[model samples]
Target: MIFYGKQSIAQSDIDAVVEVLKSDFLTQGPAIEKFEKYVAEYCGVKYAVAVTNATSALHIACLAAGLGKGDVLWTSPITFTASANCGRYCDADVDFVDIDPSTYNMSVDELEKKLQKAAVKPKVVIPVHLAGQSCDMDKIYKLSQEYGFKVIEDASHAIGADYKSAKIGCCKYSDLAVFSFHPVKIVTTGEGGMVLTNDKELHEKVLLYRSHGITRDPKMMTRTADGPWYYQQIELGFNYRMTDMQAALGYSQMQKVDEFVSRRRYLAKRYDELLKNINNIHLPDQNEDTDSSWHLYVVRVDFSKINKTKQQIFAEMKDRGICLNLHYIPVHTQPYYQKQGFKDGDFPNSEKYYEEAFTLPLYYSLTDEQQDYIVKNLVEVLQ
Candidate 1:
């Protein structure tokens, strides 16, 4: 069966993991640092802290930004729930901005309007890089400066993407940026994530928070160490460290990121060319200043002209041995968030996008034949 997305594991990836398996350390080893350094250098960032998953990365990054019970954190409603839940984990109230209709990223215009009217402005605003295309970050950065807020980019689908010639995780316009390394992502670490930042203090805080807020450093300890083995628990943290095997695999995967992204971009262009004449669907839009990694080629079906419901199209595609998936349901529409006083109509654009959109198969290994077949089946169903 054709999956909506999947990893492309080569012999090198297997060899890297096997090497780590035969090494002295498995959990907290040299491989993790090596992987982190490679990602940092690739993204042109000063530091990168690899963690168990993107959720944990976002959690620690939020804490590093001084998010607490009384603070507010805002993100796009169209993202995975983890983007908003990170704020909830820190005891900070979470809110969402509407998405831009064209790009499906957080709307900077909506953000500025919300900030102008908010009685209590958010301490942090996370602009998610939806479908690997960046939100207008220069504008977001300007707003952050004017309104005294921090920016964290939820770049889970954007590790290989670029905005204004700079890499997504460079943290040029945000205080911190996040990347996911799930099997389905551009890079795979089995299941891992990284938080990138230019600030040394933020990096230090992230390091402390990832492993139970414990510090082995003499400078950070409250009192003198009794021995070289003595460590201090300065604050509460979690066991969010990446394993050596995972890091090694991730490092190996990073070596071929450009190739992976290039193939995906080529496939995306093919889809645009083949599907452009179809009147019943809207292809993914590109922003002038960004080059997307094309993690998921999402399309909006114009159900107004079609007689079939969204469910019918999904079933038809599945019957053809093709799997289709939605990127997200609006976060505020979830039962948990609804109970928090957010209702369906609160963010009209996000809710509207949710009703019509679903992802097509887009990944490193999707060949031209498979893509053509997928498009043929899609056109047949939509027609």
Candidate 2:
């Protein structure tokens, strides 16, 4: 069955991992540094810290941002739970800003409004790049400056995406940005992530937090070392280091990111053309200032116009040997978040989007013929 997302692995990817297995160091080695440097250069960021996964990356970024008990963190509700959960990991109170209907990203207007009225402003605001399209980072940055909050971009779906000529991970509009390298993401490291930042202090903090807050560096140490083997646990942190094997594969994947993004963009345009005339189906909208990576091709099916529920449509697609998926359920609607006092109508846009949207097949390896077949089945199912 054709699924919503899949990784495109080349023989070189395998060779890179195999080569790492033959190398001297498997874990805290040169390969991770190499991959980090490559990604930092590609995104035009000053520093990068590779980690085990995006969730860990987010957690470290939150800690580095000085998020703690009594501080508040905010993000778009239409994202994976990790985006909001990272705040909870820091013992920070988590909140959500509604999304822009057009971009499916955190609305700067909503953020500013919330800030204007809130007695407790957020310590950090994480605007997720949903479906690989960037939120209005320029405006978000402006708001952050005015309100004195940090910005951490949840760029898991947007490694190869661009906003106003600069890549998403440049951190020009945010203090730090994150990228995921899961199998279904733009690039695969068999499950890896990187945090990019321009600030040297934040970069150093992220590095410290990702690896148990330990430091062997003399400059960061509280006292002089007794011997070369001296180290100290400076602060509480997690074991979030990425393996050399994963970094090696990621480094190799970096070589083909441009090609991968190019193909995804081509497919996205093709889908737009193919679906334009279809009835009662709204296409995903794009923001003029951003170029998306198209990690997901989600469409809102007007179930009210048709006789079927979303489940019926999903079942029909599955019967055609296609497995579609939903991008998210609003974070606040989850039982855990509801216990935090966020109710059904707290964020209307995300909830509405969740109800109407379902992702179509999208991946680097998806062929035109396969896409056409999927589209045909979707059209039949919708009818």
Candidate 3:
């Protein structure tokens, strides 16, 4: 069976993990520092803090942004729960902006409209780069300036993605950016994430919060330590540190990031060529100024031209051994968010996207033959 997305692991990745296993330090070793430095250099950022997963990265990023009670955080309604949940973790109000119909990223117009009408402005805005495509961060950054809010790029699906001629994690347009290395993402570290920033204090905050708010540095310590081994818990934090094993794997994967992106782009091009005129389906749209990592190739079904429901298409695809999936179901439509007074029609564009869109298989290791087979089956089903 084909997957919607899968990691492309090679021998080098395995060797890196094995070497870490034989080393003296299994967790919090030199490899973690090396991986962080490598990612920072790649993204052209001043700092990168490694964490256990993207969720932890987002949570710490929110905390670093000084999000708290009496403040509000906004993100796209089409994103995974972590994007909004991070704000809730900081005890702040969480809200969502509708997505752009074409890009499926946060709508800058809607953001401005919301900010303009609000009595209290947002403390932070987390614009998600959905489906591995970079959001129009230039516009979002301009909005942040006009509205006086900090920007956090929830770029979990955009590790190798490019935005306005620079890498997504460069933080050129946002105060901080996040990346994920889950098994199904562009790269895998057995579940890892990184937060990137140019702000010195924000980087330090992430470091402190990742390690239970403990600090051993004399400069950061409130008082002198009695012994060299003494450390202080200066702030409340969680143990979100990445392990040496995961770091080693991530570092190795970093070496092939460009290669992986290139392959995914090629696959997306092939899909574009082969599926151009399928009966009731529309391919993903691309921005001329940005390049996508093509993590998931989502197509929209034109229900007006089709007799079958999206639910039927998904069920039939699954029965045919093709694992079709939706990018999201509108986070505000989730039961938990509904309790927060968010309901079905709150974000119309995102809810409409949920009704029409489903992901096609797109991954580093997907072959042309498999793609063609999957497409043929899909075309036949639509026919």
Candidate 4:
């Protein structure tokens, strides 16, 4: 069966891992630094801190931004739980912003309205680049400046994507941006993530938080201690460091980043062309200023018109050798957030999206023939 997402590994990637295995150091080594440098340079950011996963990266980023108790964090509810959970990790109250129907990212208009009536302002606003399409960062940045709130771009799906001709991780539009290197992402580090920033202090804080909050840097120490062996625990932190083995894989994958994004875009274009004529289905739209990485090919099917529930359509597609999946359930609708006082109608746009959306097979290795087969199966299911 054709799966929704898969990694594309080359002989060079295998060779890089083999080389790391033969090396003396495996975890804390030059490879990790090299990978960090590679990503920083690629994204045109001053620093990039590699972490165990995107969740850990988000945790450190939120903490570094001074998010904590009494602070409220706002983000799009149409995302993975990690987006909101990161705020909770900092003891900050989490809130949701509705999404734009076209781009499916956070709606700036909804955000402005919420800010106007908000009893308490958010300390940070995390705009997720859902499905690799960027939110309107210029507008978000303007709002952030006016409201005096920090912006953390949850760009897990947008590593190779572009916003206003600039790379997504450049942090041009936000205070900090995060990227994922999971197996299904544009690149794979076997389960790794990175945080990018231009501010030296924030960058340093991220590095400190990713480790045990201990610092080997003598400059950052409160007082000069004994010898080179001297170190100090500056703040509370966690073991969120990415392994050198994973970094090596990421370093190799970085070489073909453009190719991976290009192939995905090509496939997305084809899918759009094929699905445009099909009724009862809605295709993803690309923002004029944003270049999407097309992380997942999600479509919204009007179950009412198709005479089937989403589950029935999904099952039919699966039986026809298509391994389809759903993008997400609205974060606020989850049991945990329900306790947070969020109900069904809290965010209408997100609830509507969750009800109709499902992801189709998309990956670097998906052949045109496979795509045609999947599309054919989808057509049959709808009929």
Predicted model with the maximum lDDT: 1
Q: Residue 255 of model 1: what lDDT? A: 99
Give lDDT tens digits, candidate 1, residues 283-359. 98988999999988999987888999999999999999999999999999999999999998999999989989999
Runs in model 3 lying further than 4 Å from the true structure: none
Consecutive 10-residue window with the lowest summed lDDT within model 3 = 302-311
The number of clashing residue pairs in each candidate reads 0, 0, 0, 0
Q: Which tens-of-lDDT digit does each residue in 1-383 have in candidate 2?
A: 99899999899999999998999999999999999999999999999999999999999999999999999999999999999999999999999999988778998889989999999999999999998999999999999999999999999999999999999999999999999999999999999999999999999999999889999999999999999999999999889999999999999999999999999999999999999999999999999999999999999976889989999999999999999999999999999999999999999998899989999999999999999999999899888
Model 2, runs deviating above 4 Å: none
Q: Which lDDT value does model 3 have at 195?
A: 93
- As for candidate 1, its clashing pairs are none
- Weakest 10 consecutive residues of candidate 4 by summed lDDT: 301-310
lDDT of 2 at 312: 94
Report how far residue 327 has shifted in candidate 2, in Å. Answer: 0.6
TM-score against native, each model: 0.99, 0.99, 0.98, 0.99
lDDT of 4: 0.93
Model 3 residue pairs with clashes:
none
What's the lDDT for all of these models?
0.95, 0.95, 0.92, 0.93
